[model samples]
Target: MILENNDFKLDVTSEIGRLRVLLIHSPDSGLGKVVPSKAQDWLFEDIVHLDTMRTGEYDYYVKLLMYFLDPDKIKGKLADIDNPESKRAFFKPDNETFHNSGKVVEIQTLLSDILQQKDIRKKLVAAVCAIEGCTYRLQLQLIDIEPVELAKIFISGSLNDEQMIFAPIPNMIFSRDIGIAINNHMLLNKPAKKARARETLLVKYIFFNHPLFEGYRDNILEIPDTVQHFLRPGEEQEGKTTLEGGDVMMVSPQHLLIGCSERTSVSGANEAIKLLFANNVVEKVTVVKIPHKRDYMHIDTVFTQVKRNVWVLLRSLTIAEPAQDESEPIAWFADKKNKDRPEIVQFRRGKKPKTFGTLEALLDNISQKDLQSTEPTRFIYSGNDEFPFDAREQWTDSCNLLALKEGVVLGYDRNDKTVGAFQKSGFEIIKVQDLLQKFETGELNPQEMTDTLILMPSAELSRARGGFHCMSMPLMRDKVH
Candidate 1:
């Protein structure tokens, strides 16, 4: 059973259960602004062409999702304000000054609403005015002029003659990292990077003002307003905590796993775990410690549950043993070339002391009741134990799969070895094109499908260093039997 929220039921207890609702953001104009020199700073491996992303594989991916999900549930980040209802709700034009009631009026209306809130209005004004180029006079003048016209000045970010108040958030398409949906409650996350801070703000604005989430304010997780905005990749600075949705996984109603990786810190996980335990929402919390590298930025980058009792994993992380008894309990990397025993290194705190015990000890505390049978907990390695194939495929997120239901999964077709591994595990592999054709010809039924892998084209999407699991943020799922 899925408990209904105000509009949709925000219930997700297991990863491989049937997906009922999802939140997806297609690539926007902001993506085109990212340049090669600043790609790494923006957390992108390489700059992707806006045209390719918009019209290529990603377009089909969103279309395929729409075929099964209700159209209303597949919300777009850029709301069309041209509609009469939207215009009325978002803007009220002033005939005396600005007559163009389309983009300018809509933005002004939102700004006006912000200015009306006495509690936050002054703070916002002070914050923007405190900047070097943003003068109080300029902000005051902005109230009258249309904001959409000044959008290029903000996006270009050259503050020479203009106030560089905003920058393009190119990574907003990976909506999974903006917020996390646990059980029936939603936690709007504070991003660990400055580049993504605005994405969190957009999500907050939606949940606070959007009609879909109107009555569920209490259900949304709350954090202090004074919290730090950004933390260095692996820096353990005090007084700040950061968490991302990509590092969170709901194993069951009672057991939740949070990975302290490059993008999520232990301090952040501790704060969340305390609240979860206090509310009696999660009985046990396992904090998995992973390598702090771009390749393994999040746990889902190397591990995901693809079907009932089945997990796709990078063997290097899960099965590898530490090099010595004195080293850390978890061995993250393996030498694919040698194809020998696991290699490990001793664990050391980055810059701050850990308030909690060793990760090994924390994970050992997982209740025995949640452990699965030996036969059922089988893992399919990314490349089926092959050499260079395993190393190359793992780098491209071969393990990151999104499950629509038990025994039905979605993956990238470029990873042939990984796809073969799934086929060897009794899953019938079918390309997205073939699957759609079957649906159109009345030969395939998604509801009755079992042990199937629906492969999606990934030539361009893989460049973003994410897969289906990273792109979607599921709000509701039918409970598994």
Candidate 2:
């Protein structure tokens, strides 16, 4: 996994062989904490029933991954392990404070009670991540702290409550958003906010220590320091760096598309690109600036690549407007007297401007652009279009599809408008329910459905702000033609 500058070529010409060996964390009791009161702040738009959501998600993983590789071939962190010795060895608390201060005992007891596990190590790990106790602890910690107070201190939320409560990570099941594996190395994402910090920790532990990934090298990246250095004076408020994997689309080994959105900033993207390029981890990183609206949280929410030279994207956001170059210059005084040490870095400032066009026009432009040049260009749409607003709305997620192989993909069954567009584009749609039935009956073989599109019912998934591709991360893909 040693990345030489020449080895990092990013080209998204096809979905083929672009990404292989994805890592995912299934939703556990951690999802139970998403309520109306806590949902929005945690980036969830709706509260979902844990049971139903899990059931739907299981179908998604089974059908989708099975289509590309053997169910046994794909790896999961939550999969069962038979060795108790191994579990204890991996999860045992290593922190001196946690072990010596009785916090380990407290955690073990709480986890055992909630997870019904007899093992102390397993219980403590799961308990710290469980929804019931985790939230109770966090809430109790924040009870009297003003938003202002909480803002000033990092990790300010409490851990002192006796009663354990956990927060729901409804988004965890969609493992692709948390981390990505490029070639032989794994990059665990550092999300923008604290609510998802646990995701980063979970990914770090799994990639570094998971038995399944023991032979692989880990290449994790964090932007806090770079953000601080690049934005200096604005680091505390405006230039806080945050980038999620969802906004990144690998066009090829040599090219990548990065979405500059609410969760990821222009400065953050610039900083990340500089690191990737300077380190030779990527040949070219194209920053596709997206909106900051809550509904459109990450770029993947609006755009996703489905096959070579073809893409399924939200017509509006993806092609709506050209991301304005809003970068602002920041001054840094490096050793005040050492005239050679003065440094200045520019940070993008202001919200992105709005687009004025129809969805089709935007897609048309993207298709026409010469994306290979070092200089960046964008495609946008004009407002007037024939489709209804609902059709356009569905296009946002309506067409956001995830591919297991070339033409084979997974999407929401309820997005008829978007589904219609796919069919029109020559995709074979297999209803998610049908696929699940076939799987249960042993009639469907994932490896056999190599180049087909499998659509999952979005009745539950759509409410949570993701689609088929959003829910699953592709670990490996056959080489593109």
Candidate 3:
């Protein structure tokens, strides 16, 4: 599936660049096993029907991505893959019927590729077995399993459909959290929750051992813990250095954004700044200290770029309604209270740190200064800036849109008000199925698609609380000059 090439590019300078390649993991068997009691612990808002997520919702996403990034794989096989009797073999990494696309890559395929080596296979098996607390006999049995099956077992935590050996990593579907690709480099994550510990371990092995990433091995950046980490917070302690990929964003070749949120701590942001500076990864790093709340787990959940001059974001970060009425004596001071406002500061090597008053201001500066957009920047607010709907749709990942090119993005169909905002912005809105049909019928082409928002089915996928942006890790893109 890797289809290794010496020319495989790894540069990603802007989030809205034309996507060439990416890493994604489809919903595995583990996603269906999430029970209600452990849903919150496992970082899910609700238990979803995994079958629907795979067939009805996510399969369309895979098809749409293939049509855009790797069309040869899905252009002619729509009917075959859409058949229920196919049992999603095209999405499964091990099956002969798998798409095995080099562009729309499956992380499991990379894991299996590295696992085929006897020594690497043994080490990975032992590591996974130890983490899952497998019996000595079972560990030995696991080591003897074939590479493809073993990789599936490692990810799904199941030996067979009937036998679950350990907890399934339902979160692996959100591959964006595993690592991120900056310009010619990969920044691996140190996740905050124990539930994601194994996910981090597995991805680290793939990124380190997979031959496709061999050349960039030296470019991989791992944030180091504080020297006094021994005295730092334990698993239950507060404010330890943990950084998830969701919190980190490479906005431009010389500009990166790191969020200090519920999953990413201030210490994590500090280490990232120092590391990127020492490594010359960027000229400026903006630290956005958002509220440490589950409501806004990462900055990406609240905002993502739709184009060089356009951003889709929650309005709460930019708009403030005074808690006290104008008639009240302390109403003016209420604005100064800074309720829910993100603390944004930019760091450059030799320059004094710069602070931004609002999220909108920082993004406008990025559009004008970093991306060189001459037009006035625009923002499409979640839920059309409506009060309760804004919060509700933000919770459903309305702001987490993934740009295929500059103006085309993928979003959930359920975010009605947000879709309305885009429609009002003179952007064309179409369901993903219809667009895919057009692509297949030659009525539309991905290259010609502009200012369009492709709506994805979200009945089951939305329950996972991540959008396509959170589900992708872009590996290559044409830089927006």
Candidate 4:
């Protein structure tokens, strides 16, 4: 099969590198269908107001990304784009007025693009039908429908606004977990939960089939399940090799971090380490395993890098001492090994595994040693490291941030305590709406922006339990200088 290569480059060398291009999914109708009872099964803590997420919250994210990554699409068009009469046509992937910027790419568009091929469309329709257990008649109907509308149904599970053909993949908006970019390679995820199974299938097809990644097809890595994984007992299923992009962080060109959390298994990290070393994708890989809890789903939920010399983290899980209770001596002893404090271990090819006592120590090592920063790494605690606030803000993703460039990041506006922490760290904070206006007025330039935190509204977006980092899959970024 011949694939005509586009001008897009598949690369991401550092967390805080200047983001050149990324993949994101705007909130679709599927996000609106998450009912309370099925929320947990669907990987959402609570159902979100789809309209508000689209117009009030996620719209700004698309605009901000466009302004920074592809300014020509957004510049001098804010008022016309937001005009009520437009009915958000500018943001809809299926609409004619959609801002199909080459830099700020959309998953839905890519899905539709691949579906245009006859053989691929037939295969994907059959695959989805088999997974969803659809009737033969429904499968035929789907295959007959046009590619654009069929692609929408595949994501939203609805033929139209009123009828749902299958369960909606509501979690698709968090595109990061679909795959991750490591330096010049793309490592896809094998999702941990049944709810995200369809997402994985759809994304795998996109990355392998999309023309934009034509030249880099061989660089796409997949983590296969362990031999006889299906035979694993139910009680031991947690040990199965399940990896998600949320747990994978490309910190530097030579280093990577894999988190063992609720969404990623220990075996997954082990497999990833072996693969990266065999491929020479990186020189070192660190597996950071935190307590298996839903609140802290992945290591990104616990901490993220803001710059080469700065990081934001949840002190309770990353740095707090293990609380020992003498009443339960055995349990307390066990907790010390894996509970309160994170288990940090770094692995390199043909080298002894190195361990760190705390996340702070590991991040500092990355800043000072891996990236060679001149100054010591600085830390900002979630919720300002206060008792209830730390836990509260962490739940809302205070630590989950996406750096636009070194020292410039994007996070939820509602995390007031975390916002205060950033302010104390000598970073200027501005709301997204205000910042967009400033950009329109030429008051601030994104390229020159530094030590800044751009706050995004999260009333509806936060209910989905992810941040900008989870919502993004960076494809190309300038090497951190």
What's the CA error at residue 300 for candidate 2, in Å? Answer: 1.2
Give stretches of model 2 more than 4 Å off. Answer: 1-20, 71-163, 227-236, 318-396, 436-451
| Residue range 1-481, candidate 3, lDDT tens digits | 4456455778999899999999999998889888888888888889899888998999988998999987887887788888887749988897888988888899899989998889999898888888889998998998899988988899888987669999888999999988989899899898888889889999999989998888889999998887888887566566688899899898999999999999998888899888889999899999998888888899999999999999999887875454556676774334533588989999999999999988999999999999989899999999998867888899999999899999999999999999999999999999988998899888998998899999999999988989999999999999898
What is the C-alpha lDDT profile of model 1 across 1-481, one tens digit per residue? Answer: 1112344666888787787677766664556767788887787887787667655566556545644554232223113422434422221222222222211112222333344444444444344445324667766654443333332222233233244455566776677888777888787776778777655654665556544455667778854423454534445354357888888888677777788888887778777876776666666666777777776788888778865467787766644443344465633443432243222222222223222333322222322234342344556888886766776788888988888877787888899999889889888999887775565455766678898888888877888889888888887788866
Q: Which candidate is the best by lDDT?
A: 3
lDDT of 4 by residue, 110-155 (tens): 8888998999999999999999999999998998888778889999
* Lowest-sum lDDT 10-residue window in model 3: 329-338
State, as a TM-score between 0 and 1, how close model 2 is to the true structure.
Answer: 0.64
Ranking by TM-score: 3, 4, 1, 2
The lDDT values for all models are 0.63, 0.48, 0.89, 0.88
Residue pairs of candidate 3 with colliding backbone atoms: none
Question: lDDT value for candidate 4?
Answer: 0.88
- RMSD to the hidden true structure, all candidates: 9.1, 13.9, 2.3, 3.3
* Total residue pair clashes for candidate 3: 0
Q: Of models 2 and 4, which has the larger lDDT? A: 4
Q: What is the lDDT of candidate 2?
A: 0.48
